[model samples]
Target: MTRIKNLADLHKIKEEVQSKNRLRSSLDYPEHLVQIKVGMATCGIASGAKETMKYLNDELEQQAIDAVVTKTGCLGYCYAEPTIEVTLPGKEPVVFGYVDKAKVVEIIDVYIKRGEQVEGIIPLNFQTIDD
Candidate 1:
């Protein structure tokens, strides 16, 4: 890890992180945009959640898509560690498994952009208390 040498550098780092973590700050996300949650628990990390998250972040920023990208804890599918849950405005959430960089592209082009479904979905097995 690189050490901060001065206050200016520290502030710069802070700004960078805050910019990337906009989802945490925006609780009431815009209703017309998409929202994504990446599973980042221990299992998820071990199975490439970090890479998936990075890819999604870069893609969303590049495409200028109006969406909120957030990191979440485990979705209880340890076998599908690199998992992601996507929610389009006014629709039920869909959980997808084995989300690699390629899958992320499809998710954006087909799921988020075109508002169509794609493969790799992990069907909901158990209903949450909110259900």
Candidate 2:
């Protein structure tokens, strides 16, 4: 981590973090924004879900994508730890497994940006209450 050499530098870092948090937690008209749910359960964390979540959050902001990246529970896909469920506006949510840095980039570029499908998607067999 970079050392905070002065109070101004510390404030700058804090503001940066706050900006990212606001973007990730934004819920206004959520139906119009891309919704990314990262599995953060124990199994998921063990598989490096924290890194996955951080990368997703940072990349989305850097790309200026209007998205909300939130954390969820197990998602019932223990075999596919570090999984993420992405819901594009006006579409059904799709869960992808084994998400790493490269997968996150592909997901943002191909799936999220261009609305194209990528591999590693875990087919949803169960329906949610909303369905």
Candidate 3:
């Protein structure tokens, strides 16, 4: 940690700390504005999921978008590694596969921001049965 010598330095440190805290808080809060789950299984990591996840995190902060980004294990879609699932408030979660940094931005701007669905969605296959 850097020592704060002046008011400006203190303020900058405060802001940085607050930003990090907010990110962690968002992850803990289930009722977050947006929840992004990046698949991080062995295959997903090999397919650049790590970079895609970082891109989403940095871009969301840069765009001042309040979102919670987390990592999950494989969704049984190894063929389409680097998959991401986005869950917006009051909407169904959509899973997109083969995500790169560019695609991640497009998902944020077009899908999350503008409410438009992008390509590369993995169709939901599981049937819900009443138990």
Candidate 4:
């Protein structure tokens, strides 16, 4: 926890809290907002998931994009650590693998903003045990 040493610190805390609140409220209508889930398991962290998650959050804020970014356990893609699942409004979620900083920028600009697909997309696995 960070100590509130001054008015500026307090204001910063307030802004952070407000931002979190807004993000929570946005979940009420998630279908209208962009949703992102970052894998943060051991494999993911080892592959720099922390940095990827931070970049996504910061970039979204800088672009003033309304998004709900959350962290999750292993997405079952250990080979593709640091993976992210992005869901656009009214669209199916797409999971991308091996996401570095440059890939993040490309995803934001091309996929998220322009609705265009980018490389490195991991095709969703659909086979069931019952099969």
Candidate 5:
């Protein structure tokens, strides 16, 4: 680890560390609430999933929304990297794809807040897994 050289450097290091830790632990929120899972696989990372995940965490906190945001492996939609699945309490999960910061905000505002579904949802033509 690099040593802190001054007060500013120390604070910067602390903030960076906190951000990383926040990313890892943000999913620990109670299960009864909504859960937001973002694909963080290699393809997802190449598609800006890291920034999207961070944006979700920060925006959720800023908006005072209490939801769990976690990173997950590939959801098999490589064409739509950076896919996100939102599991609202007592409701079926909805997956959105090709997400960016704007889409992320729209998800939070429309889906999470107003319960309105936006575009980019992968069609569920067939079901293999039984709930």
Candidate 6:
């Protein structure tokens, strides 16, 4: 964490946090929330899952998007490390690969906010044994 060097810096951080709080509280409807699952396996972490997770947490709250973000285990896409699955309200889940800060923004802005598709989508090629 960055240290607050002076009163000015402290106040700046306070304002930033307060603004985020206002945005976070705006999304009260649970039924319409977007669900996000981040893969945190060895490959995922090595490919920058931690940074991606942090970015999602902070940025999603800051944007006031109604999202339920959670950490998940290996998504069985070891080659496509740092993956995230996003399920929009009343829609099928879409797994995105090579997730980073930029991809997260695109997912939120294009996929979640605009209800449109974004790049980096990993298509479903195989089915589970249960199926």
In candidate 5, list every pair of residues with a backbone clash: none
lDDT of 6 at 82: 91
Q: Cα RMSD (Å) per model?
A: 8.0, 9.7, 10.3, 9.3, 10.3, 11.7
Q: For each candidate in the order shown, give its overall lDDT on alpha carbons.
A: 0.86, 0.88, 0.86, 0.88, 0.85, 0.85
Candidate 5 residue lDDT tens string, 48-106: 99999999999999999878898999888989988999877656789999999999999
| TM-score of every prediction relative to native | 0.74, 0.74, 0.73, 0.73, 0.72, 0.74
Per-residue lDDT tens digits for candidate 1, residues 3-110, read: 889999999999987764553334464435577899999999999999999999999999998778889999899998799998876677899999999999999999
Q: Give the 10-residue window scoring lowest on summed lDDT in candidate 1.
A: 22-31
The better-scoring model by lDDT among 3 and 6 is 3
Worst 10 residues of 4 by lDDT: 22-31
Q: Over the stretch 1-131, how does candidate 4's per-residue lDDT look in tens digits?
A: 97889999999989998775555445455435788999999999999999999999999999999888999999799998889999876677899999989999999999999999899999977776888
> Candidate 3 — which residues are off by over 4 angstroms?
1-32, 128-131
The runs of at least 3 residues in candidate 4 whose Cα sits more than 4 Å from the true structure, single-residue gaps closed, are 1-31, 127-131
Tell me how many clashing residue pairs each candidate has.
0, 0, 0, 0, 0, 0
* 1-131: candidate 3 lDDT, tens digit per residue: 77778999989988997766455445454545787899999999999999999989999999999788899998888888899999876677899998998898899989999989799999977766862
Query: In model 4, what are the clashing residue pairs, if there are any?
Result: none
What TM-score quantifies how close candidate 4 is to the native fold?
0.73
- Stronger candidate by TM-score (3 vs 5): 3
